[model samples]
Target: MALDRRWPLALFRGAVPVALGLLLWVAVTGGEQERQQTLKGRRAADLTHERRHNELLMAALREAAETEDNVAHRPVPWRK
Candidate 1:
């Protein structure tokens, strides 16, 4: 008896669907991983900005207090 001629065609049909499914899964998970990385980067940048703002605010307050203290210590030149 001759060998069947349809085996290759059947195999190809089954494999194409499996291969497509795997590719779809990879694409979806890769997008999610990229999104998570972007969120992490944004959070780090926000924290850095907030820290810098606090440092500048503290410096300004210290300078203002020093100025006030100097003015109070100065003598009134018009009086004796």
Candidate 2:
């Protein structure tokens, strides 16, 4: 009687590693997405802060420009 030697062991031999690899892939993808979301949130906060700082600097510059214009338009006391 010839023993059938390629059924139960051969089918499972290839399937187990493929199944384990798929599980590992799913876990790694989920972790990477979570990390990307965290970085995006931090980037958004940093941009908001930078915009506020730029606005403050613009207001100070405007005030200085107005002061300079006022001084330039004033009459010279020694000549008048």
Q: Can you write out model 1's per-residue Cα lDDT over 1-80, one digit (the tens) per residue? A: 88688988999999999999999999889789789999999999999999999997787567767764554355666221
Candidate 2 vs. truth: CA RMSD?
9.9
Q: What's the true lDDT of residue 46 in model 2?
A: 100
Clashing pairs in 2: none
Q: For candidate 2, give the lDDT of residue 37.
A: 93
Separately for all candidates shown, the number of backbone clashes (residues 3 or more apart, or on different chains) is 0, 0
Candidate 2 weakest lDDT stretch, 10 residues: 71-80
Q: Where in model 1 is the C-alpha error above 4 Å? A: 1-30, 69-80
Give each model a TM-score: 0.44, 0.47
Model 2: how far is 51 from its true place, Å?
A: 0.8
**Native-vs-model 2 lDDT?**
0.81
Show where candidate 2 strays beyond 4 Å: 1-30, 69-80
Residues 27-70 of candidate 2: C-alpha lDDT, one tens digit per residue? 88978978999999999999999999999778756776776455
